[model samples]
Target: MFDTIDFQALRRIGLSQALVAQMFNLQTEPADRLMRVTEVQRDRLRLHDGEAEHVAQVWPTLRIALQMQGESLVVGDWVAARRDDSLGDVCWAAARVPPVNHLVRRDSSGLRQVLVSNVDTALLVMGCGQDFNLRRLDRYLALVRLAGVAPVVVLSKADLLMDGGASRAEAVRRHLSGQVDVVALNGQEAASAQALSPWLAEGQTLVLLGSSGAGKSTLTNTLTGLAAQATGGVRGGDEHGRHTTTTRSMHRCASGACIIDTPGLRGLQVDADEAQLDAVFDDISSLAPMCRFRDCHHEDEPGCAVRSRVPAGRLLSYHKLQREAQRHEMTVLDRQRQAAEWKARGRFAKAVSRAKRG
Candidate 1:
């Protein structure tokens, strides 16, 4: 039945020929249905099979297997499932179809949370007003760059800018130094959405990233040509807003590209390697090779090319992200030591409890 589905329809849903081939390879049973996860919930998933949408959940055994593999399903992930008539329109998600690539971030616990899978571009949306911050943009660029996805910076609410966002956009461009494409647009306008049309070509996938009231939902609505997501205004003083979009969701844009809009990220920790951070700061990274000392800290050091050429604030951001990355890279010995310490504490508490009981 899936074989009979038109490729064009599947393309609209972000299924490419390569992904279709991968789906076939992942399916073991003839009756298994191939579906793309559009929305993820606490215990259930919303899947679309390019024909119909269904509420789905992973089987018990499959859940255990996925846990053993340290993998969990997220939006934009292709999966193999089967229809179960007893569940009254629910399907059993059997397994995940491996993504070509995926974007992930670390939670406060340092556990990996896969945001979206198989996206080609990441639109790092920020407001032209009080929401614009180069440091936050750099962090986003590093995350996407690490995932091997192209990163684009889109400054929304240009209409609110005093000089039509031209000066602010130029400043952002100078900060980035042409490292990534930057676009300034009004999220509610169709013509403004057209500025991003190149990356939204058919079969491509894009994800939106920003803080609250950054116009992510408005842009998604404009691109999809549907008022699917609710938009809200920001506080005049701080430009902050209540969390309007609470979950990660995928939509098919009018250009046939799929877009995933996620909840506002209040705190972003880049789940990346030091090398990835360096890649985002290529100016500083390039000068590192010219430093006299191989392991130069670039602070009051002789022949420090990086220190001499790179701006202090930019270098500080690089160092900050580097420290964060190293902190998250828990070694085997470190994890074992942590576990042993917890166990020792637990045993000591148990002994104290036994003495108290006696």
Candidate 2:
């Protein structure tokens, strides 16, 4: 099904050689239709064929298979579906082509939530006022790094910034140690399109991550040259935006790039092993090796190299995120146990629903 796709069509939808190869290896049925997931609903999904959008549901077989693996289809995923024109063009997804990378986080329950997949770059949007928080941005950057994607910190609402967001931009640069790109712009204007053109080029897929009132949806409108996502107004005093965008959706830009806009996140939990956390906090990780104790937690321990050079606040944040990672760490049996528990809960819900109806 993958090889038969036209080269131009694949590029038009942001498909790379690696993803094409992965699809081919899946060896899906020839009758299956290849489409990309644009939105995921309760019992159905909206997909695109590089042209039009169609609503589809996960086939029963595929649903059970995904349940067993503790996974679910999400927006921005390329999937193979069976389309039935006789049923008024209904579609059923039966297979998914694994994404090159996925932006994910752990919910409060410690279960993995895949936000979006097959992404090349992540746009971390933050406002300069009440919506801004350096600690929150740290979690976002860590999530992107864990997903193995490049990140660009976008400071929205530059016009409203007291100093045109210059000081805030510089602060972010210093916080990240100038390792990632930073852009300050008025997201509601056309010039934001030019400021972010490098990441919005053809075939580059980007996801916008930020809190409400940070102008994610507005930026989507500007970049796509259309009202792709609904814009919301902020509260008069606090500047918190209403939850205008309730779900994630994909929008196509004139530049041939795809933009996935997500709803605001109140809190983001970075779930990973200590080694993974170390990668995100490379500054602390690099110095840990020089500590007197190999298992140093960068605390009161003597000769703690990480404690000496790194800022006290950063070291503390590392320990906090590391603790969350450890709480959810698992082996093979742990995964099986979690999957089984989920299935049991699903069955219990079904039973209760049936009883209530009876």
Candidate 3:
């Protein structure tokens, strides 16, 4: 908690001109220091106030307000906070600046979860070992696309494969039809960071997203040039890794780019609608117009261009994603309807009581 915080290091964390303008216009407490949250813990948050990081506390009201709004302050969020000299020099955050974009997803319970915000790119890391699955990668691509973040596929653990994972990486690149750049590299090597240098330029912010034991932490350690993240061994049978990194933490690379490392997700439930999913899966989307019927499900439909052109496995993946997206939409609509019905019932009970009292 200090009296002043300048915006000199704001660009290092991908603070855009629009976000600066928004923070400047916000009417908050007497705080000139703008800070970025690097880590969010159960009780406290590690905030970097442009110069240094400080473990700061939050106003109880601030937390309550965010909770009621169904929002939480995540890593990569810029916040306005102040240090009170009168209160024994303690720090307290007042308000959070809205993020430019959010990498959002849903869990198995259909609960909305925002992965990270203010991201410029998503490094979808997948181990070339047993972790290589094109189906899962397609799901990740859709989630990143729906969030409006640029996606870059990173094939880690290349050295483990017989052919250095080149063939596997090429397959992924080909699977996506080269819509995005795919890089195959050994995550433990120093050169791996250089391979991702294009996206690590100054002012760029990236997030590493993959299942547990996909080498996210290894890549992060290499990028930061420090053994800051812990690495664990994978199971021999399934080649699956443990959840070594449990929390989300952001670290600055030597290139001045910021990388946010997250825990390996068990499953990614896409919180997207049909139109949004279409925007990500271009193969099916491009051929849908040529179908005999506009509502062609692509299953046993005569003259279905999508079914004819799309690979059987690829089509199956698309159908599965479509089903999930549709179910998420229905669940959301049901929740809204239930809320409305409850509100109507409350109003009706009040009206009846008023008539009886009169």
Candidate 1 is scored at a TM of 0.87
- Cα lDDT tens digits, model 1, 61-168, are 778987887778889998878878998888899877778888888887777877889888999999998888888887888778888999988989888877878887
Q: Which ranges of candidate 3 are over 4 A from the true structure? A: 1-5, 86-90, 331-358
Clash total of candidate 3: 0
lDDT of 3 by residue, 156-261 (tens): 9888889988899779866776779999998889998789999999889899999999999989999999999999877788766666999999999878999999
How well does candidate 3 match the true structure in TM-score terms?
Answer: 0.87
Every candidate's lDDT: 0.83, 0.85, 0.84
Cα deviation of 61 in candidate 1 (Å)?
2.5
Displacement of residue 265 (Cα, Å) in model 1 is 1.5
In candidate 3 the C-alpha lDDT for residue 272 amounts to 86
Error of model 2, residue 208, in angstroms: 0.8
RMSD of 2: 9.9
**C-alpha-based local distance difference test score of model 3:** 0.84
